[model samples]
Target chain A: MSPTSSLQPLERVRVAVDCMGGDHGPSVTLPACRAFLASHPNAEVLLVGTEESLRPAAGWSRCTLVPASEVIEMDDAVEVALRRKRDSSMRVAIAQLKADDEGHAAADVSVSAGNTGALMAVARYVLKTFAGIDRPAIAALLPNARGGFTKVLDLGANVDCTAEHLLQFAVMGSALVSALDGKDEPSVGLLNIGEEAIKGSETIKRAGELLRAAAAAGQLNFHGNVEGNDIFKGTTDLVVCDGFVGNVALKTSEGLAGMLTQMIKQEFSRTPMSKLAALVALPVLNRFKARVDHRRYSGGALLGLRGLVFKAHGSSDAFAFERALERAYDAARNRLLDRVHDRIRDTPAVLPTAPDEPAAAHAA
Target chain B: MSPTSSLQPLERVRVAVDCMGGDHGPSVTLPACRAFLASHPNAEVLLVGTEESLRPAAGWSRCTLVPASEVIEMDDAVEVALRRKRDSSMRVAIAQLKADDEGHAAADVSVSAGNTGALMAVARYVLKTFAGIDRPAIAALLPNARGGFTKVLDLGANVDCTAEHLLQFAVMGSALVSALDGKDEPSVGLLNIGEEAIKGSETIKRAGELLRAAAAAGQLNFHGNVEGNDIFKGTTDLVVCDGFVGNVALKTSEGLAGMLTQMIKQEFSRTPMSKLAALVALPVLNRFKARVDHRRYSGGALLGLRGLVFKAHGSSDAFAFERALERAYDAARNRLLDRVHDRIRDTPAVLPTAPDEPAAAHAA
Candidate 1:
């Protein structure tokens, strides 16, 4: 029987959520979880946080509360989260996923809106990396011109990565798009300054060679090198880069989008005449805003771990947080972990050997 | 006496224009030059290209045609431009800046909308680097939230940069901003993934430390590490980064802006109701467009060069090319090169030494 065959269509998909992790605490997460349970009749949530904070969700039937005494602050360091806060809502939620019985995890997936460094550290400590994978990458969906989303990683986990690590990211990213988006063979693009072969630094050029070999071996659908603009152009289904570059690109886009929105608002409210004009243009502007709404694309998967985990924006409200829950539910329902395992297992020979020395020291 | 005092306020500012460059060649450049000469009574133009292509402006006084035999194709390799196209318009224009009369440069500045790599290669070989500066950076102006522009570099020049190189870029950028914007001490922010002290790659972290030292020594007005979004937020007057990151950030912003503009248009044209709404909002939309117009910020300076050279967008129209010429004229009029020289000279003790070995191999 298949791994997912044990559950019927009407059977519940269990999700462990850290309700006290984000800036809003239970205020945002509790409502989001309630909405998620209301929509997904076959899904149940294990709310992991202090009993006092989660008191509001006591009346919900499909949602159960699991108390955790400690809280991981938004600015807490990784060492503190990893060693000190063993019972943090973030950690306890991840633990539920790890408490496997007969080779099966308890919760189908776990999610949090905690400090990224702390969350990654706790998740990695609890679930550990999948076999043959050295690092876990943070993958997020970016809106493209085709009215679709492109998957880009590593968003900020592993600040320094090797050529081998980049190759692994490509395989994982490809597997992700294939599983979630239902693409048979997702195209992967290596993020670089220029599309030319002679461009970029030594590490990037070396990564290109490894990616080419994988494509030649039928491991991935490599679309060759792509510039930053390609991320929004939908030139490829997946874009892979080291965390440093990916984080900068992601944050830069956010900054620019925020500025543009603010500028538009300022323009419409500059004068009484413009305010009247804004009323006439309200429908068009609202449509444009809904098209590029950040609430619609709120979840980012923490890939390569043995168990599934999704990260929501720390400042996300009820609507945005609910989208994160939906993303986790979709990934769990689609057997994202199994798909990743199958891809990795099939491409054993194509995987590059990790360097003997640590890659961080050599990263300039 | 000041070098500029010889020429009074109404005296001519000689400009070497590559008439046979960009997509439209003479069709765009000739008209742009004519418009530029008409606006600035103290400006003279030396139209550099084959005489046949530049025949349209033959009868204009104060507009001289300098004949060049060959043309640098938009796709020509740097080697092709440097070796084979010896008498090309791009090279001849740069040569005008190098040809000194009584120890004074012939042209105040040269403007080109040619192949960037080819132009940079030719300019560097002909004019050479400024004293104490290694690689010349490509500096461009990005629109900020304050209705002003932030100067950013290196857009795509040096792909791999050392900590010392970053320090040089900061000094040059600060000088440029101070001269143009008339700020006593223009704030310089080093671009990175996080604002925290312990974030980013080794090169970036080291650059941060050096920048801090420069700040302590009163050599630069350092604003510390800034994230990508800070570029649009107007967090600093100048953002300095390695070419790879800067180029990706810049191109990504352009792609996003273009996509948003296209999406807005698509939304308006989708249905008759939205179309009518768009017509009502046309005034406000046009105002927004004028505020963030790319044509107004077309020129990017090749900083740290012994001589001044500006790169215009290859697809620039006459209006855009005229804006570029205006930018060059402003920099020349404000004595931008002299300001850069003064800052570099004053901060001799604070400058970092170039590493003994090449830094490219360690670039991640």
Candidate 2:
């Protein structure tokens, strides 16, 4: 067979996924897998997890199982992820991806809807990173006013990150945009307290400088520092930050969305006349719903990994899981990891200026 | 004259509002102000801007016009805040608040739906902070799960803060929560990256330590550290955060709420059948409409100030402005500032830990 790295057409790519992950786990993941398989006849999934769990997901002919002896409970601590990847579903999923060289299936991507920290640790240790990437950021697409979604990285990876790590996120995020949005070089923004470069923590200020220099050198669409309020405003296509802030921003957005939707449910229950008005406005409502539901885009792509590794939401349903597998297949077809590695390798390394000397020396 | 601070059940609390501060400034603010006065029988409003601008919404009284020489454009930088305070409607509104205090008319609150940074700077500098408090925080009351709201403070007061500042926010948030919810010494949460003591930035850690000692001493109802996700979960009654992160959290929450609500509206309208379900559930929909309409909670009490300072939404309708004034009256009557002072004063000064003895000595 041609080398597995050949720009494999969607039909040639195989995606390995954790059959049991997330709240809806098998119920959601299996159906989604079948749905994805139904559309892409050649795209197959090596469903990794307990065989007993797989038996219930019945109707798939193209996909097979890679049984995992153990399962990691959603509530299991992060420590378990590193120590027990030998048996856990997430670990088995990665092991299947790493087993690509043997050509058993040439698994191009690994997908799991598991505990986030555990996934990050596994992806980091198992897949490793691109040459310049010290940390692989968890990139997710957010809905914007422009009818397009933006990618944000470090969504909840490392709580405390260095400016250098943010720089790496920008590089990887830039590549992901190329792979996903077809943008030659998507604009990169450093999520900050304010738009002004001078305003933010020391790390942000440092990252701003690196991004600015990179922008000047024609690397990213470097849109100076962006405030948290600007994320939904769609000021830029890509936002980068340390996981601490990114996690907070993401979760805060989710919380607010949950709160608003709940409140909307209550408001619709109010008076009869208002309900009538809502009926008339249902079309407009659905447009808004699809724009914000995020179910289709729930799986976050782990950038800078050796291969495509998509983390579906732990609370994901089958639709969410299927969407993730599709994303993984796309990433594999696009050779996202190789592209990131190449782009990063080709770019002139950002050299240290006097002020950035210490940061340059700092390990991300 | 009796203190205006006492809500002795006056004819209606008169509120002076700067109508030219927000993006939609006059159009939205004008109508909102009119709507507010109409709903609340005892509400009176002084619309400050140019006479020409106020005419459209001033068909009836409860509202009068206060002409200003120039309007403070929203795009003007911070420098414009101080320089144009003499000519701007926002400054004019603050001046009205002070003038009313002297005249014993004491407009219950001066509401502004304008430049937040300018509003906060002008209000605090002109109004000054309350006794024993160094700064005021724009406290946001978010809709929580228990059919109630939780308060988060220092939304954008200061970018750089200290442990003392957080301590003060906890004290003030407590007072405001008690005022709004009748909850005594409400549970207070320090907004950190994680619930664990080991989590957060150095400053947050320091603040957490201070809060721990204070809580142990029975000063505030400190519930250790609360992650950003916990904010929407409504695990605590009060959340204390520095201005930078707090501002981001509050604005992000608001933006997310608006985005999601818009999405839900669109999703319910995707097809003819869904539209019919919406039509059938018209009354249910109307009930929901009343629930998430942000106009109802369009104002926030500016905590830690000597006098009640209220912030109406930038797009506040007359109804929202009226509610803001109402919130101001409630805050003042509840002795928000005085209660904060009392609690803070009663708590003995917390000394730095032995680990920071050298730094403390150096500062002293």
Task: Please tell me which predicted candidate would have the highest DockQ against the true structure.
Answer: 1
Specify the poorest-scoring 10-residue window by lDDT in model 2 chain B. B355-364
- After aligning candidate 1 to the native by TM-score, how far in Å is the CA of A226 from where it should be? 1.0
User: A193-269 in candidate 1: lDDT tens per residue?
Assistant: 89997799788898999889978887788999999999999999999998888888888899999999998999999
Residue-by-residue lDDT tens digits, candidate 2, A1-364: 1121243344477788887778777778878888898998768778887888898655667777888877777777777878854688888887666534333434778888888778888777876765566677799988765667778888877656887888888878877877776566677778876777767777778888888877777666788888776677777889898776677777777776776666665565456765666666656665666566778778698887665788888888777677778777777767676556655654465732222111110011
Would candidate 1 be rated incorrect, acceptable, medium or high by CAPRI criteria?
medium
Q: Write the per-residue lDDT of candidate 2 for residues B67-119, one digit (tens) a residue.
A: 88777666666678877557788887876655332234345567777767787
The segments of candidate 1 whose C-alpha lies over 4 angstroms from its true place after superposition are A1-11, A99-101, A352-364, B1-11, B99-101, B350-364
List each candidate's DockQ score.
0.72, 0.33
Model 1 TM-score? Answer: 0.93
What lDDT, from 0 to 1, does candidate 2 have?
A: 0.71
